[model samples]
Target: MIGPTMTPEILARITAARAARDLSDLARQAVGTTAETISPAERIKRARRMRQMVNAYLDTVVVAEALAGADWSEITEALGRREPDTVEGEYADAVAEWSDAAEAEADAAADVEELDAWYARHREDHDPDLEKPVADLLNRH
Candidate 1:
């Protein structure tokens, strides 16, 4: 994640924006349909599910942008100026680090439908959520 943008206010804003987007989607989906028949509980559950999905998706985009927006020198350094080490040992250490981080993420993300909500907070989705180069890099994959 881009360090400074992660905050409680940002996360709350994201949740609000997701509600806006989901309502916008629901309005479209409800056209000439029986969506009005859904119970309030079901509607809330659906929104929660949608928020979780969007949060996970935006988290992925942020990570991708963090990579694509970086120069090679920065990327290499961020990966930890590699020293000679066993791939297995490095992999094990990385897993341990990620596991700890994942646990923290899980604590933040009580909304995720399943495991691996690596980062929380859905995005507000203003156009150009990511930079042009970053978007292009992601689109390629």
Candidate 2:
């Protein structure tokens, strides 16, 4: 995938803005939702899930931005890791797994409903212009 090409300052600003929006949304949801009606256990579970989602989203943004401008060694050093090769391999594997999952979902979609649902869930992650290319690549494998 092509990474963002903006300067670091611009990217930082965008990331910060997105994070602020996400925080605002989360706060709004917390206030508007039936949080008070739910059991304590359910509330805890929901909070944990939200935390995981937010952390994963932020980590993805940070890693992508870092990789766009920094060398692998720099990333490894920042991470205080000794095995850059292992980290790189793990990243490649994760990407491959994600792509395989998407391709499998597409291949298994048998009807319009299934395809529509898949597209709806993944619309934000995909570009309409790349559909043909992605399909072609998936078909070859």
Candidate 3:
């Protein structure tokens, strides 16, 4: 219980599959969008950004879920691999690594929030006029 519930091999497969699916979806969307609306270069850039965002979100969710609680036996059974005990060590190591990473990400997010709050407090010095437009664009998304 100290580490992740799924073995590293299983986790890797799941992660790869998810990433592939996300990238494929992004590619499909990019292909579907009108080239006149957005240039091919911009579309590629946006697709990369979208993929990164998706992966980041997925990482957070997976880490959180692992930390909350996962049934190792069930996962192992689903994977049709070794017994739970056989992969417990690998799972624990993966969990510990992810926990540390999650903590670091949380700290970084807090720092970003702090900086954003500071910028908000001193909006005049920062591009106060563009704030509305930026907010509008973000909201539209």
The number of the candidate with the highest TM-score is 2
Question: Candidate 3's residue-wise lDDT over 1-141, tens digit each?
Answer: 112333332333334334544565676676787555867788778868886867664554444345556666755665476687764554576667755453343333334333344445545654655433222322342
Cα lDDT, model 3, residue 132: 34
| Candidate 3 residue pairs that clash | none
Tens-digit lDDT string for candidate 1 (92-120): 44334433343343333433221112122
Preferred candidate (TM-score higher): 1 or 3? 3
Q: Model 2, 9-108: lDDT tens per residue?
A: 2333234334544565676687787747888897788778678767666555545544355566766666678887776665664434443343333222
Alpha-carbon deviation at 19 in model 3, angstroms: 16
Ranking 1 against 2 by TM-score, winner = 2
In angstroms, the error of model 2 at 78 is: 3.8
Q: Which model scores highest in lDDT? A: 3
TM-score of every candidate: 0.31, 0.41, 0.34
Span of ten consecutive residues with least summed lDDT in model 2: 105-114
**CA lDDT, candidate 2, residue 127:** 43
Q: How much does candidate 2 score in TM-score? A: 0.41
